[model samples]
Target: MAKFEILSLITSLLAIFVSCLALYRSRKTHSELVEFEKVHVKLSRRQIEEYEAKDAARQKTTLGAKLIDSGGIRLQVSNLGEASAKDIWIRIEDPDSYNPLVSGDYKQKIPYPSLNPGEDFTLTAFIPLSVTQQVYPIALRWLNEDGTQGDFRCTVSR
Candidate 1:
Protein backbone atom coordinates (compact mmCIF):
# COMPACT_ATOMS: atom_id res chain seq x y z
CA MET A 1 0.00 0.00 0.00
CA ALA A 2 1.06 3.63 -0.46
CA LYS A 3 2.47 5.46 2.61
CA PHE A 4 -0.30 8.09 2.51
CA GLU A 5 -3.06 5.43 2.32
CA ILE A 6 -1.56 3.50 5.21
CA LEU A 7 -1.40 6.64 7.37
CA SER A 8 -5.02 7.44 6.51
CA LEU A 9 -6.07 3.94 7.49
CA ILE A 10 -4.19 4.22 10.80
CA THR A 11 -5.86 7.57 11.50
CA SER A 12 -9.32 6.10 10.90
CA LEU A 13 -8.61 3.14 13.21
CA LEU A 14 -7.33 5.47 15.92
CA ALA A 15 -10.46 7.58 15.65
CA ILE A 16 -12.66 4.50 16.01
CA PHE A 17 -10.73 3.30 19.11
CA VAL A 18 -10.98 6.72 20.82
CA SER A 19 -14.75 6.82 20.19
CA CYS A 20 -15.19 3.37 21.76
CA LEU A 21 -13.18 4.37 24.82
CA ALA A 22 -15.25 7.51 25.26
CA LEU A 23 -18.46 5.50 24.98
CA TYR A 24 -17.35 3.01 27.62
CA ARG A 25 -16.27 5.77 30.01
CA SER A 26 -19.58 7.59 29.53
CA ARG A 27 -21.57 4.45 30.28
CA LYS A 28 -19.57 3.76 33.43
CA THR A 29 -20.00 7.34 34.61
CA HIS A 30 -23.75 7.13 33.99
CA SER A 31 -24.03 3.92 36.02
CA GLU A 32 -22.14 5.50 38.89
CA LEU A 33 -24.40 8.52 38.79
CA VAL A 34 -27.47 6.27 38.95
CA GLU A 35 -26.11 4.50 42.02
CA PHE A 36 -25.29 7.83 43.70
CA GLU A 37 -28.80 9.08 43.03
CA LYS A 38 -30.31 5.98 44.63
CA VAL A 39 -28.20 6.43 47.74
CA HIS A 40 -29.10 10.11 47.91
CA VAL A 41 -32.82 9.31 47.71
CA LYS A 42 -32.57 6.77 50.50
CA LEU A 43 -30.69 9.18 52.72
CA SER A 44 -33.19 11.93 52.04
CA ARG A 45 -36.10 9.69 53.06
CA ARG A 46 -34.35 8.65 56.25
CA GLN A 47 -33.68 12.26 57.18
CA ILE A 48 -37.30 13.18 56.56
CA GLU A 49 -38.54 10.37 58.78
CA GLU A 50 -36.19 11.38 61.56
CA TYR A 51 -37.32 14.99 61.37
CA GLU A 52 -40.96 13.95 61.52
CA ALA A 53 -40.34 11.81 64.58
CA LYS A 54 -38.62 14.66 66.34
CA ASP A 55 -41.40 17.07 65.43
CA ALA A 56 -44.00 14.73 66.85
CA ALA A 57 -42.06 14.33 70.05
CA ARG A 58 -41.87 18.08 70.46
CA GLN A 59 -45.59 18.52 69.80
CA LYS A 60 -46.95 15.73 71.92
CA THR A 61 -48.97 16.42 75.09
CA THR A 62 -51.16 13.42 75.69
CA LEU A 63 -54.00 12.97 78.17
CA GLY A 64 -56.14 9.86 78.10
CA ALA A 65 -59.07 8.42 80.02
CA LYS A 66 -60.72 5.06 80.60
CA LEU A 67 -63.46 3.47 82.65
CA ILE A 68 -62.55 0.81 85.22
CA ASP A 69 -64.68 -1.55 87.26
CA SER A 70 -62.90 -1.97 90.59
CA GLY A 71 -65.91 -1.99 92.87
CA GLY A 72 -68.00 0.00 90.46
CA ILE A 73 -67.37 1.88 87.21
CA ARG A 74 -64.97 4.79 87.73
CA LEU A 75 -63.49 7.26 85.29
CA GLN A 76 -59.73 7.41 85.36
CA VAL A 77 -57.93 10.32 83.74
CA SER A 78 -54.21 10.13 83.16
CA ASN A 79 -51.47 12.50 82.13
CA LEU A 80 -49.33 10.55 79.73
CA GLY A 81 -47.26 13.51 78.57
CA GLU A 82 -43.86 15.03 79.03
CA ALA A 83 -45.08 18.25 80.61
CA SER A 84 -47.11 19.23 83.63
CA ALA A 85 -50.75 20.13 83.02
CA LYS A 86 -52.77 22.57 85.11
CA ASP A 87 -56.41 23.59 85.44
CA ILE A 88 -57.56 20.18 84.28
CA TRP A 89 -61.27 19.90 83.81
CA ILE A 90 -63.49 17.07 82.69
CA ARG A 91 -67.11 17.22 81.61
CA ILE A 92 -69.58 14.99 79.88
CA GLU A 93 -69.99 15.86 76.22
CA ASP A 94 -73.67 15.11 76.11
CA PRO A 95 -75.02 15.47 79.60
CA ASP A 96 -78.55 14.91 78.36
CA SER A 97 -77.79 11.56 76.76
CA TYR A 98 -75.76 10.18 79.66
CA ASN A 99 -77.00 11.87 82.79
CA PRO A 100 -74.25 11.35 85.36
CA LEU A 101 -74.37 12.26 89.02
CA VAL A 102 -71.12 12.86 90.85
CA SER A 103 -70.84 10.44 93.74
CA GLY A 104 -68.77 12.75 95.91
CA ASP A 105 -68.00 16.46 96.22
CA TYR A 106 -68.09 17.81 92.68
CA LYS A 107 -66.28 21.07 93.41
CA GLN A 108 -63.39 19.44 95.19
CA LYS A 109 -62.93 16.61 92.71
CA ILE A 110 -63.27 18.55 89.46
CA PRO A 111 -61.11 21.26 87.99
CA TYR A 112 -58.06 19.54 89.40
CA PRO A 113 -55.24 22.07 89.90
CA SER A 114 -52.36 20.17 88.35
CA LEU A 115 -51.15 16.77 87.20
CA ASN A 116 -47.59 15.77 86.43
CA PRO A 117 -46.39 13.19 83.99
CA GLY A 118 -47.71 9.68 84.73
CA GLU A 119 -50.10 11.02 87.35
CA ASP A 120 -53.78 10.19 87.24
CA PHE A 121 -57.04 11.21 88.89
CA THR A 122 -60.24 9.30 89.46
CA LEU A 123 -63.86 10.26 90.01
CA THR A 124 -66.90 8.18 90.73
CA ALA A 125 -70.13 8.90 88.90
CA PHE A 126 -73.48 7.20 88.79
CA ILE A 127 -75.47 6.90 85.58
CA PRO A 128 -79.17 7.48 85.70
CA LEU A 129 -81.30 4.34 85.57
CA SER A 130 -83.20 5.69 82.57
CA VAL A 131 -80.12 6.11 80.38
CA THR A 132 -79.63 3.30 77.88
CA GLN A 133 -76.45 4.45 76.10
CA GLN A 134 -73.50 2.13 76.44
CA VAL A 135 -70.97 4.80 75.57
CA TYR A 136 -70.49 8.17 77.22
CA PRO A 137 -68.37 10.91 75.63
CA ILE A 138 -66.25 13.05 77.91
CA ALA A 139 -64.38 16.25 77.16
CA LEU A 140 -61.13 17.11 78.90
CA ARG A 141 -59.48 20.53 79.07
CA TRP A 142 -56.10 21.42 80.47
CA LEU A 143 -53.34 24.01 80.33
CA ASN A 144 -49.78 23.17 79.48
CA GLU A 145 -46.82 24.64 81.36
CA ASP A 146 -46.56 27.21 78.56
CA GLY A 147 -50.06 28.38 79.46
CA THR A 148 -51.48 27.02 76.23
CA GLN A 149 -54.80 25.25 76.51
CA GLY A 150 -55.31 21.74 75.19
CA ASP A 151 -58.46 19.70 74.85
CA PHE A 152 -59.12 16.00 74.43
CA ARG A 153 -62.36 14.16 73.89
CA CYS A 154 -62.74 10.50 74.70
CA THR A 155 -65.31 7.83 75.28
CA VAL A 156 -66.08 5.79 78.39
CA SER A 157 -67.93 2.58 77.75
CA ARG A 158 -70.02 0.40 79.98
Candidate 2:
Protein backbone atom coordinates (compact mmCIF):
# COMPACT_ATOMS: atom_id res chain seq x y z
CA MET A 1 0.00 0.00 0.00
CA ALA A 2 2.80 2.42 0.82
CA LYS A 3 4.54 1.68 -2.49
CA PHE A 4 1.32 2.38 -4.38
CA GLU A 5 0.97 5.77 -2.65
CA ILE A 6 4.55 6.69 -3.43
CA LEU A 7 4.06 5.86 -7.12
CA SER A 8 0.98 8.02 -7.24
CA LEU A 9 2.87 10.96 -5.77
CA ILE A 10 5.65 10.59 -8.26
CA THR A 11 3.21 10.44 -11.14
CA SER A 12 1.54 13.63 -10.02
CA LEU A 13 4.81 15.45 -9.87
CA LEU A 14 5.76 14.32 -13.35
CA ALA A 15 2.48 15.58 -14.74
CA ILE A 16 2.96 18.89 -13.07
CA PHE A 17 6.44 19.21 -14.53
CA VAL A 18 5.21 18.49 -18.05
CA SER A 19 2.43 21.03 -17.82
CA CYS A 20 4.86 23.64 -16.60
CA LEU A 21 7.14 22.96 -19.51
CA ALA A 22 4.31 23.39 -22.03
CA LEU A 23 3.27 26.67 -20.49
CA TYR A 24 6.84 27.90 -20.56
CA ARG A 25 7.18 27.04 -24.22
CA SER A 26 4.00 28.83 -25.16
CA ARG A 27 5.04 31.98 -23.35
CA LYS A 28 8.48 31.90 -24.87
CA THR A 29 7.04 31.59 -28.35
CA HIS A 30 4.56 34.41 -27.89
CA SER A 31 7.13 36.73 -26.37
CA GLU A 32 9.52 36.08 -29.21
CA LEU A 33 6.73 37.10 -31.58
CA VAL A 34 6.21 40.37 -29.76
CA GLU A 35 9.91 41.11 -29.95
CA PHE A 36 10.00 40.38 -33.67
CA GLU A 37 7.06 42.69 -34.35
CA LYS A 38 8.90 45.50 -32.62
CA VAL A 39 12.02 44.98 -34.69
CA HIS A 40 10.03 44.69 -37.92
CA VAL A 41 8.15 47.87 -37.16
CA LYS A 42 11.44 49.70 -36.94
CA LEU A 43 12.69 48.14 -40.16
CA SER A 44 9.51 49.13 -42.01
CA ARG A 45 10.00 52.73 -40.98
CA ARG A 46 13.53 52.66 -42.35
CA GLN A 47 12.19 51.24 -45.62
CA ILE A 48 9.81 54.16 -45.97
CA GLU A 49 12.75 56.51 -45.85
CA GLU A 50 14.57 54.43 -48.43
CA TYR A 51 11.53 54.41 -50.71
CA GLU A 52 11.24 58.17 -50.46
CA ALA A 53 14.90 58.80 -51.26
CA LYS A 54 13.99 58.42 -54.92
CA ASP A 55 11.70 61.43 -54.58
CA ALA A 56 14.49 63.48 -56.10
CA ALA A 57 13.36 62.12 -59.51
CA ARG A 58 10.00 63.70 -58.68
CA GLN A 59 8.80 60.21 -57.94
CA LYS A 60 6.98 59.63 -54.66
CA THR A 61 6.15 56.05 -53.71
CA THR A 62 3.99 55.06 -50.79
CA LEU A 63 2.48 51.80 -49.61
CA GLY A 64 -0.27 51.22 -47.07
CA ALA A 65 -2.73 48.47 -46.07
CA LYS A 66 -6.06 48.64 -44.30
CA LEU A 67 -9.18 46.60 -43.64
CA ILE A 68 -11.70 48.16 -46.01
CA ASP A 69 -14.51 45.58 -46.04
CA SER A 70 -15.15 42.25 -44.36
CA GLY A 71 -17.44 39.45 -45.42
CA GLY A 72 -17.61 37.45 -42.22
CA ILE A 73 -13.93 36.38 -42.52
CA ARG A 74 -12.77 38.12 -45.67
CA LEU A 75 -10.78 41.37 -45.71
CA GLN A 76 -9.64 43.94 -48.25
CA VAL A 77 -6.17 45.46 -48.23
CA SER A 78 -6.39 49.03 -49.48
CA ASN A 79 -3.53 51.10 -50.82
CA LEU A 80 -1.04 48.29 -50.98
CA GLY A 81 0.94 50.03 -53.71
CA GLU A 82 0.72 53.05 -56.00
CA ALA A 83 0.60 51.63 -59.56
CA SER A 84 -0.20 48.46 -61.49
CA ALA A 85 2.65 46.10 -60.69
CA LYS A 86 4.10 43.40 -62.86
CA ASP A 87 3.91 41.23 -59.76
CA ILE A 88 3.55 41.60 -56.01
CA TRP A 89 4.44 39.31 -53.10
CA ILE A 90 2.70 39.62 -49.76
CA ARG A 91 3.10 38.01 -46.37
CA ILE A 92 0.51 38.36 -43.57
CA GLU A 93 1.61 37.74 -40.02
CA ASP A 94 0.11 37.22 -36.60
CA PRO A 95 -1.22 40.53 -35.35
CA ASP A 96 -0.11 39.85 -31.80
CA SER A 97 3.40 38.87 -32.89
CA TYR A 98 5.73 38.42 -35.86
CA ASN A 99 4.63 34.90 -36.72
CA PRO A 100 3.31 34.59 -40.28
CA LEU A 101 -0.43 34.17 -40.60
CA VAL A 102 -0.16 32.38 -43.89
CA SER A 103 2.42 30.81 -46.18
CA GLY A 104 2.86 31.53 -49.91
CA ASP A 105 1.34 34.55 -51.67
CA TYR A 106 -1.24 35.11 -48.95
CA LYS A 107 -2.47 38.23 -50.79
CA GLN A 108 -2.30 38.12 -54.58
CA LYS A 109 -0.72 41.25 -56.00
CA ILE A 110 -2.41 40.51 -59.29
CA PRO A 111 -5.61 42.07 -58.02
CA TYR A 112 -3.66 45.13 -56.97
CA PRO A 113 -1.11 44.98 -59.77
CA SER A 114 1.48 47.77 -59.46
CA LEU A 115 0.82 51.11 -57.89
CA ASN A 116 2.55 54.07 -59.50
CA PRO A 117 4.56 56.56 -57.47
CA GLY A 118 1.35 57.93 -55.97
CA GLU A 119 -1.39 55.83 -57.53
CA ASP A 120 -3.74 54.06 -55.15
CA PHE A 121 -4.57 50.37 -55.20
CA THR A 122 -6.75 48.03 -53.20
CA LEU A 123 -7.07 44.27 -52.76
CA THR A 124 -10.16 42.41 -51.62
CA ALA A 125 -9.46 38.90 -50.41
CA PHE A 126 -10.20 36.49 -47.63
CA ILE A 127 -8.06 36.62 -44.53
CA PRO A 128 -6.26 33.31 -44.15
CA LEU A 129 -7.16 32.93 -40.53
CA SER A 130 -9.93 31.86 -38.17
CA VAL A 131 -8.95 34.30 -35.48
CA THR A 132 -11.89 36.48 -34.47
CA GLN A 133 -9.93 38.96 -32.44
CA GLN A 134 -10.05 42.62 -33.53
CA VAL A 135 -6.39 43.50 -33.20
CA TYR A 136 -3.22 41.80 -34.43
CA PRO A 137 0.10 42.29 -36.22
CA ILE A 138 0.26 42.44 -40.04
CA ALA A 139 3.39 42.66 -42.18
CA LEU A 140 3.73 43.07 -45.95
CA ARG A 141 6.60 42.91 -48.45
CA TRP A 142 6.17 44.58 -51.84
CA LEU A 143 8.27 45.16 -54.94
CA ASN A 144 7.23 48.03 -57.15
CA GLU A 145 9.71 48.28 -60.01
CA ASP A 146 12.53 45.91 -60.91
CA GLY A 147 14.68 46.40 -57.83
CA THR A 148 12.55 48.80 -55.83
CA GLN A 149 11.05 47.12 -52.78
CA GLY A 150 8.91 48.33 -49.91
CA ASP A 151 7.65 47.03 -46.59
CA PHE A 152 4.51 47.98 -44.72
CA ARG A 153 2.95 46.88 -41.45
CA CYS A 154 -0.19 47.39 -39.40
CA THR A 155 -1.89 46.26 -36.17
CA VAL A 156 -5.60 45.89 -36.78
CA SER A 157 -8.64 43.62 -36.76
CA ARG A 158 -12.26 43.80 -37.91
Candidate 3:
Protein backbone atom coordinates (compact mmCIF):
# COMPACT_ATOMS: atom_id res chain seq x y z
CA MET A 1 0.00 0.00 0.00
CA ALA A 2 2.86 2.43 0.90
CA LYS A 3 4.64 1.55 -2.37
CA PHE A 4 1.47 2.35 -4.34
CA GLU A 5 1.15 5.78 -2.63
CA ILE A 6 4.79 6.66 -3.44
CA LEU A 7 4.30 5.71 -7.10
CA SER A 8 1.24 7.97 -7.37
CA LEU A 9 3.18 10.94 -5.90
CA ILE A 10 6.05 10.45 -8.38
CA THR A 11 3.70 10.28 -11.38
CA SER A 12 1.88 13.47 -10.38
CA LEU A 13 5.18 15.42 -10.12
CA LEU A 14 6.31 14.04 -13.49
CA ALA A 15 3.07 15.15 -15.10
CA ILE A 16 3.42 18.67 -13.68
CA PHE A 17 7.02 18.92 -14.89
CA VAL A 18 6.01 17.91 -18.39
CA SER A 19 3.18 20.46 -18.40
CA CYS A 20 5.53 23.27 -17.37
CA LEU A 21 8.01 22.37 -20.10
CA ALA A 22 5.27 22.39 -22.70
CA LEU A 23 4.03 25.81 -21.54
CA TYR A 24 7.53 27.25 -21.76
CA ARG A 25 8.02 25.94 -25.29
CA SER A 26 4.61 27.29 -26.34
CA ARG A 27 5.47 30.80 -25.15
CA LYS A 28 8.85 30.73 -26.86
CA THR A 29 7.28 29.66 -30.12
CA HIS A 30 4.71 32.44 -29.93
CA SER A 31 7.45 35.02 -29.46
CA GLU A 32 9.35 33.68 -32.47
CA LEU A 33 6.22 33.84 -34.63
CA VAL A 34 5.58 37.47 -33.72
CA GLU A 35 9.11 38.42 -34.75
CA PHE A 36 8.72 36.53 -37.99
CA GLU A 37 5.57 38.45 -38.79
CA LYS A 38 7.44 41.75 -38.51
CA VAL A 39 9.71 40.74 -41.35
CA HIS A 40 6.68 39.97 -43.52
CA VAL A 41 5.69 43.62 -44.07
CA LYS A 42 8.95 45.43 -44.66
CA LEU A 43 9.26 48.20 -47.25
CA SER A 44 12.38 49.38 -49.02
CA ARG A 45 13.61 51.70 -51.76
CA ARG A 46 14.23 49.67 -54.90
CA GLN A 47 15.62 52.12 -57.45
CA ILE A 48 16.47 55.71 -58.30
CA GLU A 49 16.93 57.21 -61.77
CA GLU A 50 17.75 60.69 -63.00
CA TYR A 51 16.88 62.21 -66.38
CA GLU A 52 18.23 65.42 -67.92
CA ALA A 53 17.48 67.38 -71.05
CA LYS A 54 20.00 68.94 -73.40
CA ASP A 55 20.09 71.81 -75.89
CA ALA A 56 19.02 70.62 -79.34
CA ALA A 57 21.82 70.05 -81.93
CA ARG A 58 24.34 70.07 -79.02
CA GLN A 59 22.51 67.12 -77.54
CA LYS A 60 24.42 64.69 -79.75
CA THR A 61 27.76 66.44 -79.32
CA THR A 62 27.99 66.86 -75.51
CA LEU A 63 26.81 63.74 -73.76
CA GLY A 64 28.25 65.26 -70.60
CA ALA A 65 26.62 68.67 -70.81
CA LYS A 66 26.82 70.59 -67.56
CA LEU A 67 23.96 72.92 -68.43
CA ILE A 68 20.73 71.03 -67.77
CA ASP A 69 17.65 73.19 -68.40
CA SER A 70 15.13 70.56 -67.28
CA GLY A 71 15.50 67.37 -65.35
CA GLY A 72 13.51 64.79 -63.42
CA ILE A 73 14.00 62.31 -60.58
CA ARG A 74 12.37 58.93 -60.26
CA LEU A 75 12.11 56.79 -57.16
CA GLN A 76 10.82 53.25 -56.81
CA VAL A 77 9.45 52.10 -53.46
CA SER A 78 8.80 48.40 -53.04
CA ASN A 79 7.31 46.11 -50.44
CA LEU A 80 9.70 43.20 -50.21
CA GLY A 81 7.59 41.19 -47.83
CA GLU A 82 4.69 38.78 -47.57
CA ALA A 83 2.15 41.19 -46.09
CA SER A 84 0.48 44.35 -47.40
CA ALA A 85 1.30 47.83 -46.19
CA LYS A 86 -1.15 50.73 -45.84
CA ASP A 87 -1.24 54.50 -45.35
CA ILE A 88 2.14 54.97 -46.94
CA TRP A 89 3.58 58.49 -46.98
CA ILE A 90 6.91 59.97 -48.02
CA ARG A 91 8.50 63.32 -47.11
CA ILE A 92 11.66 65.02 -48.30
CA GLU A 93 13.55 66.34 -45.30
CA ASP A 94 15.08 69.42 -46.89
CA PRO A 95 12.81 70.91 -49.52
CA ASP A 96 14.72 74.16 -49.59
CA SER A 97 18.01 72.55 -50.54
CA TYR A 98 16.91 69.75 -52.92
CA ASN A 99 14.00 71.77 -54.40
CA PRO A 100 12.02 68.86 -55.90
CA LEU A 101 9.14 70.13 -58.01
CA VAL A 102 6.22 69.07 -55.87
CA SER A 103 2.64 70.20 -55.70
CA GLY A 104 1.07 71.69 -52.59
CA ASP A 105 -0.48 68.38 -51.73
CA TYR A 106 2.83 66.61 -52.22
CA LYS A 107 4.62 69.08 -50.01
CA GLN A 108 2.24 68.10 -47.28
CA LYS A 109 2.64 64.37 -47.86
CA ILE A 110 3.41 62.25 -50.93
CA PRO A 111 0.94 59.46 -50.33
CA TYR A 112 1.73 56.15 -51.94
CA PRO A 113 -1.21 55.14 -49.72
CA SER A 114 -0.92 51.35 -50.03
CA LEU A 115 1.23 48.54 -51.38
CA ASN A 116 0.69 44.80 -51.51
CA PRO A 117 3.18 42.03 -51.04
CA GLY A 118 5.90 42.13 -53.72
CA GLU A 119 4.38 45.31 -55.14
CA ASP A 120 6.09 48.59 -55.96
CA PHE A 121 5.30 52.27 -56.39
CA THR A 122 7.19 54.64 -58.66
CA LEU A 123 7.26 58.35 -57.83
CA THR A 124 8.59 60.78 -60.42
CA ALA A 125 8.99 64.51 -60.15
CA PHE A 126 10.47 67.31 -62.23
CA ILE A 127 13.37 68.67 -60.20
CA PRO A 128 15.63 71.63 -60.61
CA LEU A 129 18.77 71.17 -62.65
CA SER A 130 20.78 71.93 -59.53
CA VAL A 131 19.37 68.81 -57.89
CA THR A 132 21.90 66.40 -59.38
CA GLN A 133 24.31 63.79 -58.06
CA GLN A 134 23.42 64.68 -54.49
CA VAL A 135 21.87 62.70 -51.65
CA TYR A 136 18.59 63.88 -50.23
CA PRO A 137 17.20 62.74 -46.88
CA ILE A 138 13.73 61.26 -46.93
CA ALA A 139 11.23 59.92 -44.41
CA LEU A 140 8.90 57.00 -45.11
CA ARG A 141 5.96 56.02 -42.95
CA TRP A 142 3.46 53.22 -43.28
CA LEU A 143 1.22 50.82 -41.46
CA ASN A 144 1.12 47.08 -41.83
CA GLU A 145 -2.23 45.47 -42.57
CA ASP A 146 -2.12 44.16 -39.02
CA GLY A 147 -2.08 47.78 -37.73
CA THR A 148 1.62 47.87 -36.93
CA GLN A 149 3.07 51.28 -37.80
CA GLY A 150 6.56 51.63 -39.21
CA ASP A 151 8.87 54.53 -40.07
CA PHE A 152 12.03 54.38 -42.13
CA ARG A 153 14.72 56.95 -42.83
CA CYS A 154 16.10 56.78 -46.34
CA THR A 155 18.25 58.68 -48.83
CA VAL A 156 17.72 59.30 -52.52
CA SER A 157 20.57 60.01 -54.95
CA ARG A 158 20.12 61.64 -58.34
Candidate 4:
Protein backbone atom coordinates (compact mmCIF):
# COMPACT_ATOMS: atom_id res chain seq x y z
CA MET A 1 0.00 0.00 0.00
CA ALA A 2 1.09 3.54 -0.66
CA LYS A 3 2.34 5.64 2.35
CA PHE A 4 -0.18 8.35 1.57
CA GLU A 5 -3.04 5.83 1.56
CA ILE A 6 -1.86 4.43 4.95
CA LEU A 7 -1.64 7.96 6.43
CA SER A 8 -5.17 8.74 5.23
CA LEU A 9 -6.53 5.52 6.75
CA ILE A 10 -4.82 6.34 10.09
CA THR A 11 -6.32 9.80 10.13
CA SER A 12 -9.81 8.46 9.48
CA LEU A 13 -9.49 5.89 12.30
CA LEU A 14 -8.26 8.60 14.69
CA ALA A 15 -11.17 10.86 13.80
CA ILE A 16 -13.72 8.09 14.41
CA PHE A 17 -12.17 7.28 17.83
CA VAL A 18 -12.21 10.94 18.93
CA SER A 19 -15.84 11.29 17.82
CA CYS A 20 -16.92 8.22 19.83
CA LEU A 21 -15.19 9.49 22.99
CA ALA A 22 -16.80 12.91 22.63
CA LEU A 23 -20.25 11.37 22.16
CA TYR A 24 -19.81 9.21 25.26
CA ARG A 25 -18.72 12.16 27.41
CA SER A 26 -21.57 14.33 26.13
CA ARG A 27 -24.15 11.67 27.00
CA LYS A 28 -22.72 11.25 30.49
CA THR A 29 -22.77 15.00 31.16
CA HIS A 30 -26.30 15.29 29.86
CA SER A 31 -27.51 12.47 32.11
CA GLU A 32 -25.88 14.02 35.17
CA LEU A 33 -27.40 17.40 34.52
CA VAL A 34 -30.82 15.85 34.02
CA GLU A 35 -30.55 13.98 37.31
CA PHE A 36 -29.59 17.14 39.13
CA GLU A 37 -32.50 19.03 37.58
CA LYS A 38 -34.92 16.27 38.57
CA VAL A 39 -33.70 16.36 42.17
CA HIS A 40 -34.09 20.12 42.33
CA VAL A 41 -37.58 19.99 40.87
CA LYS A 42 -38.68 17.27 43.31
CA LEU A 43 -37.39 19.20 46.31
CA SER A 44 -39.12 22.35 45.17
CA ARG A 45 -42.36 20.45 44.70
CA ARG A 46 -42.19 19.09 48.26
CA GLN A 47 -41.70 22.56 49.69
CA ILE A 48 -44.62 23.89 47.68
CA GLU A 49 -46.86 21.08 48.91
CA GLU A 50 -46.04 21.86 52.51
CA TYR A 51 -46.83 25.53 52.10
CA GLU A 52 -49.95 24.87 50.06
CA ALA A 53 -51.24 22.40 52.62
CA LYS A 54 -50.89 24.96 55.34
CA ASP A 55 -52.43 27.73 53.27
CA ALA A 56 -55.34 25.60 52.07
CA ALA A 57 -56.17 24.56 55.60
CA ARG A 58 -56.34 28.17 56.71
CA GLN A 59 -58.26 29.43 53.68
CA LYS A 60 -61.44 31.54 54.22
CA THR A 61 -62.67 31.07 57.79
CA THR A 62 -64.39 33.43 60.22
CA LEU A 63 -61.59 33.10 62.74
CA GLY A 64 -62.50 35.10 65.83
CA ALA A 65 -62.89 35.14 69.61
CA LYS A 66 -66.07 36.08 71.46
CA LEU A 67 -67.40 36.49 74.97
CA ILE A 68 -70.64 34.57 75.33
CA ASP A 69 -73.35 35.73 77.75
CA SER A 70 -73.67 32.23 79.24
CA GLY A 71 -73.43 33.64 82.77
CA GLY A 72 -69.66 33.53 83.40
CA ILE A 73 -67.17 34.66 80.74
CA ARG A 74 -67.81 32.12 78.02
CA LEU A 75 -64.92 32.73 75.65
CA GLN A 76 -65.81 30.76 72.47
CA VAL A 77 -63.11 30.90 69.82
CA SER A 78 -62.95 29.14 66.48
CA ASN A 79 -60.05 28.43 64.13
CA LEU A 80 -62.26 27.80 61.05
CA GLY A 81 -59.97 25.07 59.73
CA GLU A 82 -60.07 21.37 58.87
CA ALA A 83 -56.47 20.42 59.44
CA SER A 84 -54.89 20.95 62.83
CA ALA A 85 -53.32 24.28 63.59
CA LYS A 86 -49.59 24.32 64.14
CA ASP A 87 -49.28 27.47 66.21
CA ILE A 88 -52.58 29.19 66.95
CA TRP A 89 -53.29 31.82 69.59
CA ILE A 90 -56.43 33.54 70.88
CA ARG A 91 -56.37 36.82 72.76
CA ILE A 92 -59.41 38.23 74.54
CA GLU A 93 -59.26 42.01 74.68
CA ASP A 94 -60.88 44.32 77.18
CA PRO A 95 -63.08 46.81 75.35
CA ASP A 96 -62.21 49.54 77.82
CA SER A 97 -58.58 49.32 76.70
CA TYR A 98 -56.57 47.11 74.31
CA ASN A 99 -55.41 44.80 77.04
CA PRO A 100 -55.30 41.05 76.81
CA LEU A 101 -57.94 39.55 79.04
CA VAL A 102 -56.77 36.05 78.12
CA SER A 103 -54.13 34.72 75.76
CA GLY A 104 -53.37 31.23 74.40
CA ASP A 105 -50.22 31.15 76.49
CA TYR A 106 -50.58 27.38 76.98
CA LYS A 107 -48.22 24.76 75.59
CA GLN A 108 -50.72 23.63 72.94
CA LYS A 109 -50.85 25.83 69.86
CA ILE A 110 -54.57 25.57 69.15
CA PRO A 111 -57.13 25.65 71.93
CA TYR A 112 -59.34 23.19 70.10
CA PRO A 113 -56.34 21.60 68.33
CA SER A 114 -58.52 20.32 65.48
CA LEU A 115 -61.54 21.92 63.78
CA ASN A 116 -63.63 19.59 61.63
CA PRO A 117 -65.96 20.47 58.73
CA GLY A 118 -68.74 22.66 60.11
CA GLU A 119 -67.58 21.42 63.47
CA ASP A 120 -65.99 23.90 65.84
CA PHE A 121 -64.51 23.18 69.25
CA THR A 122 -65.35 25.63 71.99
CA LEU A 123 -63.53 26.09 75.28
CA THR A 124 -65.81 27.66 77.87
CA ALA A 125 -63.27 29.35 80.13
CA PHE A 126 -64.85 31.34 82.91
CA ILE A 127 -63.20 34.41 84.36
CA PRO A 128 -64.29 35.82 87.68
CA LEU A 129 -66.73 38.74 87.76
CA SER A 130 -63.85 40.97 88.76
CA VAL A 131 -61.95 40.46 85.45
CA THR A 132 -65.14 40.41 83.40
CA GLN A 133 -66.59 43.64 84.82
CA GLN A 134 -63.22 45.38 84.66
CA VAL A 135 -63.24 45.23 80.87
CA TYR A 136 -66.12 46.31 78.65
CA PRO A 137 -66.76 46.30 74.90
CA ILE A 138 -64.72 43.14 74.72
CA ALA A 139 -62.88 42.15 71.53
CA LEU A 140 -61.62 38.80 70.33
CA ARG A 141 -58.43 38.49 68.28
CA TRP A 142 -57.09 35.40 66.55
CA LEU A 143 -53.49 34.96 65.41
CA ASN A 144 -51.65 32.20 63.62
CA GLU A 145 -48.30 31.80 61.86
CA ASP A 146 -47.59 35.21 60.28
CA GLY A 147 -49.95 37.57 58.48
CA THR A 148 -52.98 35.60 59.73
CA GLN A 149 -55.32 37.62 61.95
CA GLY A 150 -59.03 38.06 62.73
CA ASP A 151 -60.91 40.34 65.10
CA PHE A 152 -64.49 40.51 66.41
CA ARG A 153 -66.23 42.50 69.09
CA CYS A 154 -69.12 41.83 71.39
CA THR A 155 -72.57 43.48 71.19
CA VAL A 156 -73.28 46.74 73.02
CA SER A 157 -73.11 46.34 76.76
CA ARG A 158 -76.44 46.40 78.63
- Using lDDT as the measure, the top candidate is 1
Instruction: Write candidate 4's Cα lDDT for 1-158 as tens digits.
Output: 99999999999999999999999999999999999999999999999999998776565344544556666545555555443332335544444443433344333434344443355444445455455544445444544343365455653231
TM-scores of the models, in the given order? 0.60, 0.40, 0.47, 0.41
* Residue 59 shift from truth in candidate 3, angstroms: 50
Residues 1-158, model 2: lDDT tens digits: 69999999999999999999999999999999999999999999999887776552233234555555534333344443334333444445754443323323344344345555445544444444564556656665665454566567776565
**Consecutive 10-residue window with the lowest summed lDDT within model 2:** 96-105
Clash count (model 4, backbone only): 0
Clashes of each: 0, 10, 0, 0
Error of 2 at 34 (Å): 58
lDDT of 3 by residue, 38-136 (tens): 665332111111122222221221000011223445556777655666777776767676645356645454566667776776555556665564766
Whichever of 1 and 3 has more lDDT, that candidate is 1
Give the candidate order by descending lDDT: 1, 3, 2, 4
Whole-model Cα lDDT of every candidate shown, in order: 0.83, 0.57, 0.60, 0.55
Kindly report which residue pairs in candidate 4 clash with one another.
none
lDDT of 1 by residue, 99-148 (tens): 45374655677788888899998888676668788888889999887667
TM-score of 2: 0.40
**lDDT at 119, model 3:** 77
Lowest lDDT 10-mer window, candidate 4? 98-107
The parts of candidate 2 lying over 4 Å away from their true place are 1-54, 57-60, 70-74, 80-86, 95-112, 117-130
Model 1: how far residue 137 lies from native, Å: 0.7
